[model samples]
Target: MLMETPRLVGAFACLEYSFPFVTMARRWFVTATGIQVRRFVPNDEQGVSALILPIQREEFGIPITAEDQPDLKAIPTFYQIGTGDFWVAVQGDHVVGSIALKDIGSGQAALRKMFVAAPFRGKEFSIAARLLDRLIEESTRKGVTEVFLGTTDKFLAAHRFYEKHGFQEIAKEDLPASFPLIAVDSKFYVLGLNPE
Candidate 1:
């Protein structure tokens, strides 16, 4: 017998996801509501842009545009090269979030393009966490030893989020030479799969 118990709390969506035989990993799965997390498909480019651009430009006050970021125009060639890939979270036809891993060679990769809409940015949704977890898991499986990322100090919430998920703060000098350092990203972080 299967049971479907639904409860509402204030303005938040369903807070409990009952799993009869699921492990902790599955616990982080984007099972909240009808949102589905998956790899980036060709059609997702437009949606990805729409979802990420506003977050970076309007919300974060970054002066970047789609033109400055050529990688967005060529995610397959830029991000899907070697062990790198991009992912998006969607509900119906709308993209709610996006994340990507760029293989920078030397057994290291760079985490990029992590953006979740304001409506979906909280523990209630776990969109950011799921995206980060997915990137880390996939990169590790592809033999990526360490994941490097850069961010501006403006993203205090993002810094906390990354740190909470095992990413350690590192000086810019510690980053690999091949790492694609973003101009706006002043602070840097790294997470090693095989920590020494």
Candidate 2:
């Protein structure tokens, strides 16, 4: 079903514990259509993993060292356990990508860990732009006045994506220490969803 608040559009279905079944339905829709999109759910565990792992390896190029694999494992778990607002894209039963928005503070949030799998790369920008449009609108409804993100240097594509969607680089000196993982070789950007 679809629900709308002034800030965002939300869609959901209760699949009665049939994740694989729902995945199949999503894939079929993708194969038949040119693109597929949906809100992210905690139940999309496997699809979430599929969407994330390749991005982690490719963007960070962290070798399978003693600490790497477990770190990679920790990410999706963090996403599942930490936040409730996520979005997913699917094509013909395969999950192609995902993005997450997490509340950071009063009237603020963070966009985190966005990725698009190889097969869905070309449409990444448009898909993400549309999703963010919805998410930002929804955030306004939920009382978020701004949203921020920390993105790695390697994600040149993502940096461009953020710019096109109206995010601006935040001066490093002005950033708060409380921004999670913000100091870790990533640039920060902010979008004023409710500009004064």
Candidate 3:
């Protein structure tokens, strides 16, 4: 004998006990949601641009365009070379977020291009955290001892997130000589990987 139990079907709390086996069985059925974080490929240029440009320009009111950011136009050559790497978060066929690490040498790298689509943010989705985790794992594997980042004061949420993830705020002048300080970046941070 199988017992029937209510199943949740969305916004409305409707009790559905149509399938008794589905309620009685201890087996779990996992479905693919098509969300993934992966390395950047040449084919992702358009999707990456589509995902990042609006956030930087329209949302934040940054004057820069996608064309002005050469890195977005040449991810493979600019980010995939040496110890540098770039990753994107995708749902189905749409790119939702992106993060990149730039090898500045001296056991250090610069974190850049951290962006998440408006619809895919927050702890429930964890898209930003996944992107950052991927970058940090890759950095450690590549022997990067420190990871530095630069951002504008406008990104208050980003500041809190970075701080929560162990990135200590640092003075701009303290950045590595090789760290590329963009014009819009007024705040800086560094995360030391190696035990010091």
Candidate 4:
């Protein structure tokens, strides 16, 4: 049976079963620039992939395939487990950006898969900031005391963006044992959350 629930413009909601096996999709209203950041749903797999993969491979010249990144293939299984969560910034039906937090235990999490499409980036859209804010807010609520992330030095703009948002660069040896360090990760950063 199909069920309807009232949801806030940009809020996430549980899936509603329509035909015993079919799931009804949840929709979020258009925000200021016709974009809304919300939690990942199964239907978002393709959109998320389209938004992230090309940026990682084509734009950055990373010699990697989607297969090498298991998290991208199964976001819910990889990110939604434990305190981890993944989010996507959607402009209408297209996913324009994405960010994920992978809980690494000990009140800590690993930030991953942060990518914004070229058209949606910059100060006007602030898509990256929105995605980061959502992830940080959710992480704080789940008692994640610290968040770590690894990135390639090639991402100079990303480095500046992360630092601008209070992430401090740290050495490889400083990373938590559970932080998943990918082969391409040459630079690392950490953000400490204040319980206050």
Q: Give the TM-score of candidate 2.
A: 0.68
TM per prediction:
0.82, 0.68, 0.82, 0.83
> Which digits, one per residue and each the tens of the lDDT, describe model 2 over residues 1-196?
1111111113321111134334322222122255566775546656666456545654466332324334223444443333326667765455566777776666677777577654345653366666676667767767777788887787788889889888999866555555556434458898887733
Candidate 4 Cα outliers beyond 4 Å, as residue runs: 1-32
- Candidate lDDT scores, in order, read 0.79, 0.58, 0.79, 0.82
Give the lDDT of residue 112 in candidate 4: 95
Compared with the true structure, what per-residue lDDT tens digits does model 1 show for residues 133-153? 888778878888999999999
Residue-level lDDT tens digits of model 3 in 1-196: 1122223334321222224345322211112255699999888787787667767776788887765899888888888878899999887655678999988888889999999866567886788999999998888888889999999998999999999999999998899899998999999999999522
Candidates arranged by TM-score, highest first: 4, 1, 3, 2
Looking at model 3, residue 15 earns an lDDT score of 24
lDDT ranking, best first: 4, 1, 3, 2
RMSD of 1: 10.9
Report the C-alpha lDDT of model 4 over 93-181, residue by residue, as the tens digit: 77778999998999999999999866566887889999999998998888889999999989999999999999999999999999998
**Residue 39: error of model 1 in Å?**
0.3
Candidate 3, overall lDDT? Answer: 0.79
Cα RMSD (Å) per model?
10.9, 10.1, 12.2, 9.1
Q: Note the clash tally of each candidate.
A: 0, 8, 0, 0
